[model samples]
Target chain A: MARPDQIRFRRSTLGEDVYEALKGLVLEHSLSPGDRINIDALAREFAVSPTPIREALARLEADGLVRKRPLVGYTVSPLLTRAEFDAMFEMRSLLECTSARWAAERADAAHREAVSAEAATTVAPQEDDPDGWHAAFTALDARFHDLVAEASGNGLLRDGIDRLHAHLHLHRRYFPYAQASATVEEHRRIAAAIQAADPDGAEAAMREHLARARERHLAAFD
Target chain B: MARPDQIRFRRSTLGEDVYEALKGLVLEHSLSPGDRINIDALAREFAVSPTPIREALARLEADGLVRKRPLVGYTVSPLLTRAEFDAMFEMRSLLECTSARWAAERADAAHREAVSAEAATTVAPQEDDPDGWHAAFTALDARFHDLVAEASGNGLLRDGIDRLHAHLHLHRRYFPYAQASATVEEHRRIAAAIQAADPDGAEAAMREHLARARERHLAAFD
Candidate 1:
């Protein structure tokens, strides 16, 4: 059981708390895709009434995170098929490439330097420690792209791009074993292109990197 | 008053009902940007408990459609200023141009014919009636771009584009008087480019059209 203070500090509503708990289960694969969620059990475990649980489930349904049957209630949304995964990467590449291009044109000296430093932190070889290296690279990669979105000076675009990235991250954890070195090299090239203020080069580099990543992920499934 | 059937059909949970109702109010501009939303009165009007209203408000807060103060409660989000609006259009121009390029590459004969028909409907002079012309042109314009997104065969891209279009439309109602005729002509050219399957031409046409639209919208603010 969570401490009372911890729960209070989270400042989440009952519905939101329920949603996050359920989403965590899905993300960790403890609640596998297409598995029906037992709402009654969840309500009992959470020490909350069923109404908030139902509301949370409906909200998740709206988000495409869960699906509901007419009489059977909700289940976790399925894992992305290979084609859907590719489509997701393609969308990400398009938006992120544009974001990087805009950032190259708009980023201030401080922002560019910070991004470069973050990228540098991920460049050292960690061949013996794939998981640690992957975690570091993922954090740096997200920060770099987020910085680009902020530099683009479009809140709406940034919000949309961020949401898509979050949704994609759920599926990304499964492919941690695929070509970490090449992934790091691609990130280095993307950072270098942005630092050079080469918008077209940055766009091309990011697109190629995402395309390669998608291929690698799909290859693992096969 | 809405029909009894409509009301009955809507009776799922109080939170869902309040959410749909508030979204309608915002989309219709009945609750204009920056207008204060009184939660107590809304709860009373809906004849539901305050908990559901609070939950619905929280969701709206997450969606960026409403602003919540620490103690002052909620209000409708404000309209974007001229600069913010221009930035949004810049992003839209990029995404839409890419969509047009993809559409030109992928659109079949049937899709091309449908877009061409919509474009034709939009091009004839309705110059004397700016409001009616704007409405007609806007609907046709939405169909043209939506078709392009659909033809791209990327569901993620289509969903992102649709959401951006919706958020952008909230401010579009303010731009009714700005070179609406020239805008229609530009759409006609873009449609022709798509019909001819000219990828570069379609992209260029969309870029020019969006640039002009941005200028006109900003000029109106000045």
Candidate 2:
């Protein structure tokens, strides 16, 4: 489960940013769920001491990205359970729908333009480069949602959605090209509603998209 | 600014409970906003080594309850800004209103009974024992809201609300006896609606209560 570039820390002389690098590994599933972290091995990987790795792990433990038992050290958190997945989608719908409504009503010119630009970018997976395509596709998808949240003009709502642990790894394995295309269409609908300054329409569109996304994610379990 | 009981770690023989004790200090405002944590002082207070104290601070930083800087160690997070307070209230209204509606629609007999019990509770702050009374009053208020959220059957919604970093300290100092009573009456209205299985009534009551609460908290900034 190890790769040479698994966790490419910037490796500042002062240990400036090991935390973000480590967090990226966990979020991207390079560390893999339920894997016990090997601090010494990671230290060797970066040609640094173990202090920075341990420090990063401590912070990750608090973020619920990792768990620390008395003797077990730390393990990346298990994948989201079915019940957790359902509840999170409920929370997402509640927040994101409101975000869309607010974005439609009050977004500035910049936020509007930015969201539209993000929504308009769409692509299908390449047969020979599926991994590369999936990476670009999901990155764009996350940015689209984040932009809508930013346009909502509510910092708390943005932060709330930001904290929800994203299960992008599930998409890498289970999400098909057809579903990816459908998701882009959903984004375009949401963007159109926002561009029209139609709060009700934006909210309704967001609700529909989230309901469908929930169903799509649930298919992973089946 | 130190209280003998400020940290009050359970002092497990294994040093297992230090993180919780440290988190309590920050949550209760005993550590105070923007106060630089004196790890050595805290270690001495708990009669433990500095290792546990440092460990807990790392976790609190991840929780956004504390901040760390280049040359500086950890400091408790600053109090919420007026904008943050307003945004958080908006989020609270969204989630709590949904929780109330769900409680009305689908709460089992036990959840209904528990919510009714919490809502029926009422009290006024005693002038002679204002601190004592405020403690009991605010605790009950938190419990009442938590019970309704639990009754909603959405663990993610409940968890989102819990992570909002309660500013109960605002209530202790700024909220008065009449306001305390009014808050209880509002709780009763919400509880009664939920008990009666009226989703519209419960949602409306919760929305109204959150609006009033927003106004109450705004008084702190003014």
Count of clashes, each model: 0, 0
In candidate 2, position A10 carries an lDDT of 34
Candidate 1, residues A1-222: lDDT per residue as tens digits?
666754445455666778788766665566777788888988999999877787677656655677766456779888788778877777788788888787677777777776666666654457898656655666566776777777666777787677666566456355455466677678778778888888888788888988887777676565
Mind listing the fnat for each candidate?
0.25, 0.65
User: Which pairs of residues have clashing backbones in candidate 2?
Assistant: none
Supply the TM-score for candidate 2.
0.86
Residues B105-161, model 1: lDDT tens digits: 888888887767766664444668765655566666677678777776787777767
The C-alpha lDDT values of all candidates are 0.73, 0.79
Candidates 1 onward: DockQ, in order: 0.30, 0.44
Q: Could you tell me which 10 consecutive residues in candidate 1 chain B have the lowest summed lDDT?
A: B5-14
Task: List clashing residue pairs in candidate 1.
Answer: none
Model 1: how far is B47 from its true place, Å?
5.7
lDDT of 2: 0.79
Most TM-score-accurate candidate = 2
